[model samples]
Target: MNHPATPQEQDYPLSAVPLEARKSLASMGLVLLGFTFFTATMWAGGSVGTAFDFQTMLLVLLIGNLLLGTYAAILAFIAARTGLNTALMSRFAFGQVGSKLSDFILGFTQIGWYAWGTATMAILLVKMTGLSQAWEMPLMVVFGFGFCISAFIGYRGLEWLSRFAVPAMIILIAVSMTIATNDGGGLAGLSAIVPSEDMSMAAAITLVFGTFVSGGTQATNWTRFARSGKAAVVATLAAFFIGNGLMTLVGAFGALVYQQADIVDILVAQGLATLGILMLFLNLWTTQDNTVYNFAVAGCNMFRTRRRKLVTVVGAGVGTLLAVLGMYEWLIPFLILLGTFIPPVGGVIMANYFVAWRARYPDLETASLPAFNLPGLAAYGLGSLAAYTSPWIAPVVGVVAAALAFALIHVATVAVKERRAEMMKPV
Candidate 1:
C-alpha cells in the first residue's frame, strides 16, 4: 500500500485534519487546565474531607491526580504527534475494523455522561430558581434547549466556552476558598472539625483515583488540535495538576468550613449562592458541551451521517428526558463504572501509537494505515473484560492489561512478518 503524503508533502490535501486556530500558551494552558476543578473531584474531595484530616486528604488527592495527570500528559503528547482524535487513532492500533468496537464503547460511555451532566445542570437550575415542585419538567426543557444549542455549535464553540469558563471558574474558586477559609476560623479550625469514622481510606482513594482518571476518555479528543507534542503534554499537565488540583482543594476547604458534604450548599450558606450558581453553570456547560460534541462526532462517524446538529439535538433531548425522569441519582453508579470502562481504550491507543508503530512511522500524517491486526483486538477485549470483572483493581489492571496485550500482539506480528520475508529470500 502507498504511504500517504505528509501534511508538509501533500499537494492538494483531500482531507483537512481540522486545524485549531493557533492559540497562545496561556489560552492553551487554560484549556488544558480544567483537571484541577472537575465536578467529580470537587464532590469526592468534599466527601473525603468530611472524614479525613486535610493533610491526609491532600496526600491521597496529590498522589491520585499526579499519577493520572502524568499518564494523560504522555497520551496527549502521542495524540499531538499524530493529530488524530482518539477514536480515529485507535483504528491504527486496533485495525480499522476492530477500532469500531472501541468507538462504540466510548460513544456509549460519553452519551451516558452527557445525560448525567444535563440532569445535574437541570437540578442545579431548579435549586437556583427555587420553584417548589413541578420544576422538573421546565428544567428538562431548559436543559434540552441549552444543550442542543451548545452542541450544535460544536468544537469551535466549545473552545470559546472553555476560554470563558476556565477563568470564571478560577475566580469563583478563589472566592469560595477565601470564604471557606474564613468561615472555618482559619487553618487552626480544621483540627476542631470532627472526622466521620464511617469513611474508609480505600473509599477516599477510590474517589480520588476515579475522579482523576475520569478524563481518560477524552484524551485524544483534547490533544488532537495540539500543534506539537510539547503543546499536548503541557496542556494536559497544566489542566490536571493546576486546574483540577485547585478545584479539589477548594472542595476540601468547603468541607472543613461547613459541616456539610455538599460544596454548593456550603457556598449558599456562606451567602455566595450566586457564585455557586455561576460556577455550576459554567462547569456543566463546558463539560456537557464536550460530551455532546463528542457524541455527535462519533455518531456522524458511525453512520456516515452529516446530521451533526440533529445528532446533538437528539442526544440532548434524550438526556433532558432522563433528567426530567430524575435518573441522575441512579446514573452515578453507571458513571463510576464508565470510569473503569474507558481507561483501557486510552491504554490501547497509547500502546499502538507510542510503542507498536513508533519507529516504523515518523508521523500519522505521512504513514500508510497499518494492516488489520488481530492481536490488538484480542488485547482490547481481554483488557475490557478485566475492567468489567475486577472492580477492586480501580484502573491499573485494565490499563496494564491493554498495554501488554497490544505490545505482545504487535511484536508477534512483526516477528512473523520478518520470518516470512527471510523465507522468501531473493537471489
Candidate 2:
C-alpha cells in the first residue's frame, strides 16, 4: 500500500485525482485530439490539395497519418506514466530555467492560435448564417463572448465541449461524405480525375505533416490524465490513426469528387450547408478551447501563481482583440512559420523525457518540478537553428532536424559531465 502523505507531499499536492476523474479527463483528451485532427486535416487536405492531383494528395495523407500517429504514441506513453504537462516534464531534461523559455514560447503561440481559431469559427458561422459578409464584426463579438463564457467554467466545461464537438464532427463528415459521393458520381468518378502537373510527392507529404506538428506538443497535457501509459499509447494511436487518418482521407476524397478544393465551398455546393456550418463551428471551438486551456496551465506554472481562470480570461481577451483585427485571415502564412518552430521544441521535450532523464531519477515521477537541465537548452537551440536554415525541407523538415540535433547534443553533454566528475575524483 502507498504510504501516508508527508508534509512535502501535502504541500506540493500532486495530482491525486480520483479514478473516475482520470478516466473522464482521458476521454476528453482523446476527443479533443480527434476533433483537432478533423479540423486541421480537413482544412489542409481539402483546400491545400486543390493544386495537386488525386494520387499526390493521397500520398500526403499517408505520410502525415503515419508520422503523427507514431510520434504521438511515443509522447503519450511518457506523459501517462509521468503525469506531467510538457513544461513540468521538461525540467527533467531542460533544467528549470530552460523549461521556462520553451513554455513561454509555447504559451504565447497557443494564445495566438486560440484567437485565430475563434475568429475563423466566427467567420464560418457568419457565412453559414447567410448574413452579409460584412457581419464579421458581430460574428467576432458572438464568438469571443461565447469563448469567454466557456473558459470561465474551466476544464470541466472544456471537457463537455469536447464531448459534444467530437460527435458533431463525425455527423458532419458523414453527411458531407454522403453528399459528395451522391453528387460526384461516387468513387469511380473521383478516382478518374488526375491532379495538376505541379503537384509533387514532397508537397503532399509536407501538407499532411504540417497539419499535426503543433498537436504533437499537446501530447503530454492529455497523457498526464491517462489511467496508464498503455492507455495513453492506445488512445493516441487510435485517435490519430483512425480518427485523424479517416478525416483526411474523407477530405481528400471530397476534393477529388467535387473538383472543389475549398472545403467550405464544397459543402455549400453539395447542398450540405447546414452540416458544413456545424463542422466549422465545432472544429474551431474544440481546438481553440484546448489551446486556451494549455496556455492557462503554462501561465500558472510559469508565474508560480494560482490564477488559472484569470490568466485564461486575459489570454482569451488578447486573442479576441487579434481576431477582431482580422489576423485570422492571414493564418496560413503565420501557421507555416509557427510550424517551422514547433518541431525543434517538440524534439527537445521528447529527447529529455525518453532519453536523458528516463528513470535516472526515480523520484521524478511524483516530483512537482525538477531542477532545470542545461543540456535541454543546448539541444533546443541547435534544433531550432537547423529548422530555420534548412531550405529543402518544407513541412516536417524541422521535426527531423530538431530530433537529430537534440540527440547529438544530449549525448555530448552526458560525455562531458562524466569526464568532469572523473577529473574531480580524489583517489
Per-model tally of clashing residue pairs: 7, 5
- True-structure RMSD for candidate 2: 3.9
Give the candidate number with the greatest TM-score. 2
Which parts of model 1 are misplaced by more than 4 Å? 1-23, 34-37, 197-203, 212-214, 359-372, 388-393, 420-427
Go through the candidates in order and give each one's C-alpha lDDT: 0.67, 0.67
lDDT of 2 by residue, 16-75 (tens): 222344554467455545446445567667754565665666666777777777766776
Angstrom error at residue 400, model 2: 3.8
Assess candidate 1 and give its TM-score to the true structure.
0.86
Model 2: per-residue Cα lDDT at residue 96? 59
The TM-score of predicted model 2 comes to 0.87
User: Lowest-lDDT window of 10 residues in candidate 2?
Assistant: 8-17
